[model samples]
Target: MAEHANIPAGKGRSNAAILVACVAFVAGMVGMSFAAVPLYRMFCQVTGYNGTTQRVEQVSSVILDRTMRVTFDANVAPGLMWNFKPVEREVMPKIGETVKVHFTATNHSSEPKKGQAVFNVTPMEAAAYFNKIECFCFTDIELKPGETLDMPVVFFIDPEIVNTVETKDIGTITLSYTFYPQEETKPVAVLPAGKADGNQKL
Candidate 1:
């Protein structure tokens, strides 16, 4: 009689373990599926660092500086279907001098277009010395079909950059933008005391 009772109790324990294991697997899968959106977002934000890409609310400041033009040119990527061109291809910003860039972005698509842009200082060498004060890429721009906007970005080459050992050799920095339709659109809230609406400021 004792042995019979022990066998049934042991089987019951084995069944409980199997049920727990199955529940754990299902929970893990559910958790992972829900995490996909936030995970992809984290990857884009860190890699891109564009306020527009980050989808933060505020007037996106164009983050760039007029330091050097090292192989400078602008082009639209395949997906963006937009235009990115600088008013001036090559610019000279003296130490402590501030300059403005007129980046004309035109939406070529028939639907509302959006995108984020970034400027890279080549050689991956002078990144430490680069300093950018103001930019439009920090904000989001919404365009009606076939609309063109004159976006202004003001930046200055930091006086320290010229003094820095590594960046002094840099002669050019290229500023460019790429526009694409936003996925998982996050609204950038307008501040109450912020500059006028997008139209008013432009």
Candidate 2:
């Protein structure tokens, strides 16, 4: 009877170990899935896949005489209570010439709101050559109620764009930005005495 009992106890310990191993494997997979999102976005940005634009630190040194028409588009996602639009509809910029464009955003909600902008370039092939030096899309924006802000984006088209067979003939490139609400909230800004709204004194 004692020998039989020992065999069953050993089997139970082995079964428990197997269960733990399986649980660990599942947790690791879940972690990888979460990590994959940002990794995939980085990959697209680097390769210019899916119209994702590239980020650069400095302005282009070479400016081509040939100019290209670039258009702007702005959108607000469903959850964010903000009004967003490009200050300018379009501009003609010479290749490799740095240009700055502005977009305005106003928070219509009563409370402070945070949002992040995602951007992309149209004519898919042009994304690889459309580089951004400074962009508001890089970080989250926090705005107090009725606060309006002008956001700027500085970028230049790569001179190499004219050399590429796929992009050389492209006439116009459209840059679009969409704002979405952030999951985390930021601290609200305190208003001064007698100041009820962003404008107008009590």
Candidate 3:
């Protein structure tokens, strides 16, 4: 009876150890959940895994004969009372040539508004080949009541895009941005002003 009692005690200790391991694993996974978003964002930026493009300091000098149509898109999140649109419908630029475009944003609210833009490119694989030299999306934007500003983005299509089999056939890419009011700012809503309803898709 003593020996049998020792066997059960040993089994109890083994079960306790397994339970501790499982708890530790669950805790570790929960901790990772908090860090997942930013980590995944960094990974995508580095690898262009999803339509996230590259940011380069200097423009590429090597130009290619291939041309691509770059389109712009904009949207204001429900909580944000602002009008935003691309200045142009589309641009055709040869590979490796830099181009500049503007997006105008206006606050239609009676109170000051603060917002930030989140952007991505379409045709996910082509993201790795789109390089941005300068972009207003890098920082937060604030607008006084009824104030308007033209945001600019300077970019170039990488000439190397032609070398990659995955992106070689992609002759068009759309750069889209969506603006959301900062939660901390607590922006008030107001009726939209002129041309605010124009959400052009081209």
Candidate 4:
């Protein structure tokens, strides 16, 4: 009778162990899914995969006689009532020459709003050689009602681009930016009243 009674208890213990293992496995997968996005973004930024551009601290030191036409494009995601556009349509800069371009954003809505910009370079192959030294896209932007702000981007094309078979023949590169509405957060510094633009980084 005692031996028979122990059988059910042993089976229960086995089932409980399996249940715990399954729960742990599910938890691990959930954690990985949460981490995957930022990890993948970092990977893309470093490798310039999928049209992602590279970020650099210093401007390129080498300048070539060759020049490339770089065009700018801007967009605003739905729900953000803002007017965003590149100040310049296109620029022709020599390889390795640092260029500064401006973009303007105006908040047309009645309330203050926040936005974050994402950027990419087309001719996907050329993204690997296009580098940004300083850009407004690096952080979130805030604008009060009826306020207009001018943002700047500083970048350069790598001279080695001409040596790379994949990008050597590329004549033009297009850089595009899209702004999406962001939830309200810590306020960003704003320009003094009556000032439409300022040199300060937003």
Off by over 4 Å in 1: 1-72, 184-202
| Residues 102-173, model 3: lDDT tens digits | 999999999988899988999999998889988888888999999999999999998888888998888899
CA lDDT scores, all candidates in order: 0.59, 0.94, 0.89, 0.94
Candidate order (TM-score): 4, 2, 3, 1
Cα error of candidate 2 at position 44, Å:
1.5
lDDT of 2 at 202: 40
Residue range 9-82, candidate 1, lDDT tens digits:
78999999999999999999999999997786566544433321222223323433544552335666677777
Q: Which candidate is the best by TM-score?
A: 4
Tens digits of per-residue lDDT for model 4 on 131-174? Answer: 99889899999999999999999999999899988999999999
Candidate 2 on 46-160: residue-level lDDT in tens? 9788999999999998999999999999999998999999999999999999999999999999999999999899989999999999999999999999999999999999999
Worst 10 residues of 4 by lDDT: 193-202
Ranking by lDDT: 2, 4, 3, 1
| TM-score head-to-head 2 vs 3, winner | 2
Q: Would you give me the overall lDDT of model 1?
A: 0.59
* Model 2 spans with C-alpha error above 4 angstroms: 1-21, 185-202
Clashes of each: 16, 0, 0, 0
